[model samples]
Target: MRPSGLRHHHRLETRAVTRFEPNLRIPGPTSLPPSVREAGGRQMINHRGPEFAAMLGRIQTGMRPYFGTQSEIAVLSCAGTGGLEAAVVNVLSPGDRVLGVSIGAFGDRFAKIAEVYGAAVDRVSAEWGHAARPDEVRERLRGGDYRAVLLTHNETSTGVMNPIPDLAAAIHQESPETLILVDSVSALGAVPFEMDGWGTDVVVTGSQKAWMAAPGLAMVAASERAWAAMEIAQMPRFYLDLRRHRESARSGETPWTPAIAVIYQVDEGLRLMAAEGAENVFARHEACAAATRAGLEGLGFELFADAANRSTTVTAAWIPDGVDWKAFNGEVKRRGVVLAGGQGKLAGKVFRVGHLGSVTVDEILGAIATLETVSVTAGRPVEVGAAVAAAQRAAIEAGIARVPVAAGA
Candidate 1:
């Protein structure tokens, strides 16, 4: 008696169901805000035009406070790894001695890049879940005349953030002339970094991690000392040359064609971050991290990272015994919650939850609820809602107030 469309509408009205919402819980390429998404869809612009120059200038200025530097910022059209390569190629000459302080996989990669570029790379490695202690670094620096030392500000693979200030101080004290090159790709915006204050020479970061933008641009900060190195250091470089980037940036341009759309997204993302205030943004990340850790603890999951070294950007937890990791992940995904599996040596042992870049405590609470539900579906039943409740308390305790979804978070 009714048309197909009317019958379909009648069937939908007869039952209750909620819309599917996906939570992308990964270390990087975080979910974007609506305005950021719209900005990224803007029509292409001439790379050398005035409009692009103005936008590039704004981004360069906006990035200063987050980087805690007044030094030159080179906006390169590449991922974070490319930025690290730039740091290596532009600063040190072939056969230069380098110390790589590795806490996790990314840390190792920084060293590997230096080695590939012909530097004599020696490593001071810490256990996977722990951070590199200052004492060990101090001891190592005392023994060698290292030209530069590569450090990771945050190791997302293991969910650990190194004590940069302390490590930098130790390096300077032991080897005062050694340049401090930091890979802050996963930490800069989410965590606090003081490039000049900490005497860091080069700090490289990416657009995707905490900037709430797509994976296209790698931003690097170079101190005066680092620029001086560029004058004499002789590692072969053309495309990833910081000197070229620095020169072109004087006119608000990139060395090559830039990722125009990603810059648009970064422009909007920087605007959102500025409106939120830097301190508040840091606090929000802290609150979300605390909530995530508390929630995981409530679910009887052992955290992979050490308590004192846990990263605010991502939280890694051990996959519980008696539960199939693949099955558990599938269940979580089926419910529209996508979590990150462990990397490197932790491949089958841990799972990571990313909570940064416009992520709110409420969103984390939802993910926690999903995890609790999925755990039950996997036959590991615990008290329902306990993890969510724990997360709520932790967030509140971390000075987070309930905020609107669009309140510049």
Candidate 2:
């Protein structure tokens, strides 16, 4: 037998369980409401069961107001990219001419997806951190005979929000037959997206972003014109078949097994969002974005995107001189705050701050405080109190702050 002292010396290692804090800093997979999380924990139902059908029908009905469309909502057991693929495959045939506007990584992905589907993709490249103007898109559409035009309503990577209404009007004016497919993954709910009123043929979004639910599900709404185009298109598709989804959804079911847990969460999240009112949700995003920008400016960090085109979901800030971005990011992480790094060609030069679904003024303030501490500690000269104060001022002006406070008070 071992000695008595040795027996008492056994170390008990206790690991700290990471608590689920609301994600108030980024655009997607934002903080889920407690009610949504509770719903996600509900007992799973059979995919083909009546309960599932009822849930699916209720979700489709809930999505209508967010999309601002009377078109059928196709729920797919995939991410936003799946919805993008569905849009490409369902409405266009192989060797069809398509024009894709590329302002950031997501836009580039759209062009790549089109190419993979055997479309003759013409990329209209624009400078990163800026929106491609309607006139520019118009020029490209007028210059070629294309079957469709692809655009992103919000380029999350560069924090640029495109002017969709004006762009749609321009496309219709120049090439009325060219179908319009928009990736509203980051813009839906956070911004006003009127698919029917704007004449967009197809709009795709995911549950994670503005929906404030877990990932793994995508939603698409296709106009009658887009459905008509799908009827004659020769593109090959099976699991992502919009036609099948449309048919099944009409019957209040899905062609395949749905992510029951995620659907439960999505249903609850959408219910909460609808109850708060879509316009109010959009306004919250706008105010949060403005506050974030004002806070960053107050800290003396330069914004990467133009003011007019700034995304309501995220903001890209250039790394100031003398600050070690890596170290600063590490410090923020150590403080239990996570921020997104720049993607593509912007890596290391900038960082993204998300202000989308479920974010609050206090969370934004906490992040700003962390930023201020890290920047100052890393030898980057920043006005410590300025950013937080500016954010507080913005919160008050937007009526988000319950108690009024002066800008510098």
Best by lDDT: 1
Compose the digit string of candidate 2's lDDT tens values, residues 1-409: 9987666565321221243552357667676767777888999888887888988988888888778898899999999999999999999999999999988999999989999989999989889988988888888887689999999999999999999899899999999999999999988877887889999999999988888788989899999999999899988999999999988877778999888899998888777776677767776776777788888888888999988899989999998777777877877776667888888999888899988766666778778877776677777668778888898788668767321111111
Local distance difference test, per candidate?
0.90, 0.84
Query: In model 2, which regions exceed 4 Å deviation?
Result: 1-24, 399-409
Clashing pairs in 2: 25-354
Query: What TM-score does prediction 2 earn?
Result: 0.91
- Please give the RMSD of candidate 1 to the true structure: 3.7
Give the alpha carbon lDDT tens digit for every residue of 1-409 in model 1. Answer: 7899999998775432343557888988898988898899999999998999999999999999999999878899999999999999999999999999999999999999999989999999999999999999999888788999999999999999999999999999999999999999999998888999999999999999999999999999999999999999999999998888888988878889999999999999999888788888898999999999999999999999999999999999999888888987877776677899989988999999999888889889988998898777666767998989999999989998445233443
TM-score of each: 0.94, 0.91
What lDDT score is found at residue 9 in candidate 2?
61
Among these predictions, the greatest TM-score belongs to 1
